[model samples]
Target chain A: MSNHELPRTEETRVKRLPEKQVFDRAALNALLDDAIVGHVAIVRDGKPLVLPVGIGRDGDTLLIHGSTGSGLFREIADGRPLTIAVTLLEGLVYARSAFESSMHYRSAVIQGSATLVEGEDKLTALGILTNHMMPGRWEEVRDTTKKELAATMVLRVPLDVVSVKISDKPVDEFEDDGDDRAIWAGILPLRTVAGAPIPSAMTPEGTPVSPSVIAQTIKLA
Target chain B: MSNHELPRTEETRVKRLPEKQVFDRAALNALLDDAIVGHVAIVRDGKPLVLPVGIGRDGDTLLIHGSTGSGLFREIADGRPLTIAVTLLEGLVYARSAFESSMHYRSAVIQGSATLVEGEDKLTALGILTNHMMPGRWEEVRDTTKKELAATMVLRVPLDVVSVKISDKPVDEFEDDGDDRAIWAGILPLRTVAGAPIPSAMTPEGTPVSPSVIAQTIKLA
Candidate 1:
């Protein structure tokens, strides 16, 4: 699991469009770190259920948390088989033909059963998630109370079985496809940017924006 | 299915955080339109498999496509039960405590079996998808040829069983909670913006940016 290259297993193999598959462990980690949200899928009564979840990466494991009362979270905490799909849409590629038009994206699919984090490890996992989401805010904010910790369920999924696919190149074209060059063909790059912070009603009138917010905005930009 | 409100089936009910559930059909459609990608979950060999797919909404149905040779696409075309989750991250909410810090997001979970679109309807579905993804480009690009159509598999799932959850409000605070008001608490708004277009090598020199690309950038901003 600590290797530089991701394991090539039958389930993780990219059978379709094999050229897009990425085996580098670094690439997988980058994708997980860049994307703040992911979709988790689990089976319930022989039917597939998927939902969006906030995610964080802690070394070779992915960290996600939910309320202890959530049914889906409980299923995952019980070690139900699950899959998490994280995708970052980079841009839209325009080609001369509609069939050739596509999007530039980096996506990773991870499959594994989750293990619930408890005791001291749970506190560390919570800190990792908090700082991962709001970089420097953990030290400024109050610590989690014992009640809050009991109500929260943190789960970790090992990143052993994973598949990564990246489509960041330009539009595809055949040499003799007879497509007109005059038609515009290019990429419209997309990015998620942070705007000015809006203070809540509870905040004091002269209070300055948190440093974490400023840092996050600049990082996204 | 054409009603103004979404049906509240047992499966579509929001068991957790019921306060965030939205039952309006228009909200669901709007969320689907605003998001260009979704994660589709399906059962493969009794295990959950999820992947990101380009999405489009045509009337009361959601359209998604993949290569005809894809095993997941084939399974979806065969009417396997699936769920598609589409989420838009609006901003990051900062609170006095880490437990209250969260993201402002709008998400919809749609569950149903897909039906394959064939013949003339498939062509229409393709156009719907293309334009939905890259607005106004379908009219400018060349039509899909027979060979290209044969290699594409488009599936449509009814917008019937759906669950929409939105968390856009400011931070939650309880009176006399002993949290300091001087600490900043607010929302760092987030938006997906588009940058200048980059022409592909095949594009002719001095070619103007496509109208669709400009429009999409403006729309995202």
Candidate 2:
């Protein structure tokens, strides 16, 4: 593998479809960048617990923030083993046979312990997260206050132990599989589209839409 | 709480935002019906592992299936503790301050040990899954073969231990919070839209699009 490829470790290896395993670090980064929400898993009270969280990738580390008063965030900040899974479903595949039918998706599962970001670095991480979710949002808004920073808990998860899987194969039909060739089979493409921005009721009349919102709407469209 | 409300147990209670907790069983069912994918988490070798799976809710049970050859599915079949999280991101909330910025979402977290489905009930569950993913698909497609049934592993997770959180609040702006009202603040709505179906190359030239595909496209639209 090239130096740019992710290491094939025991936990990071794809067991079912090895061919679908993506080793390129660039592919992993791209998937992380495209997806906005991630399901974060942690062992709580000797049982599995998973919750959805806003996610952003900063360099090789994944950033997720929660309230400082949150019990779950406290547990994650305590260095418990955690796993984050981000999946973007691209389309629904309709094969001739039900067994061959599946989804076209890009998913990444990251395994690591989170390190809490504090002091000045916390502000920078927050900015990265803001811009990641709403591009150009940081400059459009005011600076975060000290109290706001203290109330937020930003945790950084290294992208070291990660497994990326992508299923984007076109519809394949068996030549002699006895399925009806007349049965229409293909893909129904699905995508997340952004609608027009709706200004808040408190906003003064005729206040123009923010640049970040306009840019994001165009990008998502 | 009413008789139709879900039990608010220690594990199933919303920890961070108590007010956002949804105990209504119908709300839980509605969220499950609207979402297509769920991130399932299980503890393996003292660490957490999370993966994405297509999900369908049948009455009070959540159904998920995987290839029998998958090791992870085998682990889940053995009755290991599992947590499934399904989140629907509706919009991005642009609050007056960075601290208040959040996503409007309906998220459900179900924690339980999965029960393996076998025998004739497995076929019924498969039909439910097929129809859930593609409405009216079970009738249009050919029946699954015995070998195909044997190759698939279906698991049913009860909705007993569950927590549902909904963040559908309108953009909240503090009148005296000192952030610029001139900054466009509101929600940028987001949704999954299904595009027109593309027939496979193997499909007969004159084959018509399946009713399920057309219905699903309109429903998603």
Candidate 3:
């Protein structure tokens, strides 16, 4: 195994179609960096509740922060078992048969118990989250106040137990030897695009859009 | 309340910031219609598992289908509590303060028990799923055989206990009352864009792209 590859644990092993599983840490890092939102799963009242929250990665740890007033966050801060999933829909896979049709995606599921970061660590995690979503805005925005910090909960889940899956195989490979040569089988790639920035009404009449926002939109385009 | 408003039950009540909760059924329908994938939450061995699955709405019931070989689907088909969450991140809300920075999103969470659909209902549910992802292709693709249908599991979760949240509030309102008036605060709209279709290697050189695929690309653009 390469130096950056993540070790496969019992929980992280892909049981179904093991060929699709990816163990490279670089692949996992890229997936986490490209995604802005992740689904956080936790058991509440004997039922699983999946909540979408903004996510960020600080080195090897995945950080998730939410309002302390949220019931789900409060339950998650108790250091219970949780799973966070980030899935990017890359393309639509077209096939000759309905059964073989699927989506091309890269999904990373991290299962671990979260530990709440308090005091100064919480502030740093919040910074990481803000910077991940909108780069360079954290420096321009006002510093977080004591009251504001108290109102939030920042939890970190180490990338210890991770399962990554990338499904980009061509669907026509199954039909290359078959009788269906006329069928149109291929992929339609999809990606997130940023649109023009809309200044808020409260902003000064002549204030220009932030440099980071402009850069982001250009990168996306 | 309007007749189209969804009933607020104990399970569907928006506990955090009740004012942000939406009850309009039209809004709910629009969200489900626009989204192709949803994170389905279920408990396995006392831990919450969140799986992203293709979702489709057939009237009031939301259809979720997967391979029968999936262990998660097998557990869900046995009639257990499940929560399906669909979130669309519309824009990044930038504020003068880091604490107020957030994402504008439309999210709907439906909590209920799923029941397995068999025979004719399963085939119809599969059609709904396919049509939701790519309209008009279901008719063009090869018909689903009996063995193919048998290999898939279609589970229906009623939109009975649904909670919708739309966070479109302008974050600049906080800056207007605060001390930071020089900061640039605005929204960076985000959306998924479709790229040019790439035909499979086995496809004929002159074969045209499918009608549904062309329509989808145009719509996305």
Candidate 4:
């Protein structure tokens, strides 16, 4: 193998098509935190229900918040099982043949039923959620209210049911194909940038952007 | 109602939800196009499968792509029905209580099957895909090749079967809950910013960031 073996975890089991299985915790955590939203798939009323929603993560657990009133949210809070899917697209893998083209991606899927979290656990979960989105914003924000806590539903899915997969290189050509062209074949990495911050419209004129936001600028190493 | 009175096309019949049925082409398209990835939900062998993958928009239709060699991709390209879920998080809706706190969101689930688009249609589809991610990119970059075109597969799903649900206000309270303890209970808008472009390491020094990318600066207005 040209690349060193990726760190493996007992929590991570590789299937035969294992290019899609990841056993590294650090890699998985980065992928979850880097992603802004998640697609939650759950079986409701017998058919598959897949919906896109916001998600925040901390350590080995991921927090997904749905409208407290949503039927899907109610189902999970009532002890139904749900599967959380998260992905981060790194690049478009272009190949010599259309059939070979694939995406350079990192993804994880966690399967578990979500029950409602409350009391101190609920507040701590919110902090992790906030930090997952924009690192330092939580301390600047005030504490939530008891009523506010009661109105929102937070589902925590452990990292145990997680599977992370990655495909990072260019296409591997067939030995018999007689095709070589002027096209460039390499990774064109995708990244998210923080745009001009929109200060609360009520902020006094000339107020500098908050450090919590100023520190949020993320760039590749 | 002002923008979408009649459905856009024959396939795009609006399914009446208990409360979430409205039509705004601009809003709908923006939600789909601005997103870099989306949830692709399909069923196989009696089990539901939902995956987050790269998705692009073509006018009203949405396009999803993967390896022509993947069993799942082959199934989708072979005319099996599919579900594409696209979402946009507009604001963090803070309420007086935790249960009432939620996000102001826009999402749609397009139910349809894949039709392999080729030649002129495929080129148009690529343009839409490029512009969907980087607004001015297609015009700035080099042209696509016969080899590149042949290797990639684009599946178009009509915009007909769509659902757009949005909640854009503060949470409901007892009406007389003391305002004295209420924190800010309005929408705090979130935006995608365009940061300074990082040139590819292989790209020779002094090659300025592409104008197309410069013009596509992240602006939320």
Instruction: Highest lDDT: give the candidate number.
Output: 1
- TM-scores of the models, in the order given: 0.98, 0.97, 0.95, 0.70
lDDT per residue as tens, model 1, B51-101? 999999999999999999998899999998999999999999998888898
Number of the candidate with higher DockQ, 3 or 4? 3
Q: What is the per-residue lDDT of model 4 for residues A1-221, given as tens digits with 9 covering 90 to 100? A: 11223335543454424766756677777788777678877665555567776788765677887556677677767766666778766654433333343456788777666667777888888777765554555665456767667767788776666667877755554433233333333334554444454433233356555444454444221
Over the stretch B53-164, how does candidate 4's per-residue lDDT look in tens digits? 6778776678876545556676678786677777766555444334444555677767667788877888787767666655555655556677767766778887766766
Q: Residues A132-214, candidate 3: write the lDDT tens digits.
A: 88887778787888888999989998988889999988874564335767767788898889987888878897888887687
Candidate 3 lDDT (Cα, 0 to 1): 0.85
Q: List the residue pairs that clash in candidate 3.
A: none
lDDT per residue as tens, model 2, A1-221: 22578879997989988888989999998998888899999998788889898998888889999999998899999999999999999998888777777888999999999999988899999988988888888778877888889999999999999999999888866886465777889999999999878888888989999998987787777
Query: Which structure is stronger by lDDT: 2 or 3?
Result: 2
Q: Could you give the candidate ranking by DockQ, starting with the highest?
A: 1, 2, 3, 4
Ranked by lDDT, top first: 1, 2, 3, 4
lDDT of each: 0.90, 0.88, 0.85, 0.61
Considering every candidate listed, which one attains the maximal DockQ?
1
Model 2 residue B5 lDDT score: 85
- Give the least accurate 10-residue stretch of model 3 chain B, judged by summed lDDT: B171-180
- Residues B124-181, candidate 2: write the lDDT tens digits: 8988888788887777777788999999999999988889999988887788757577
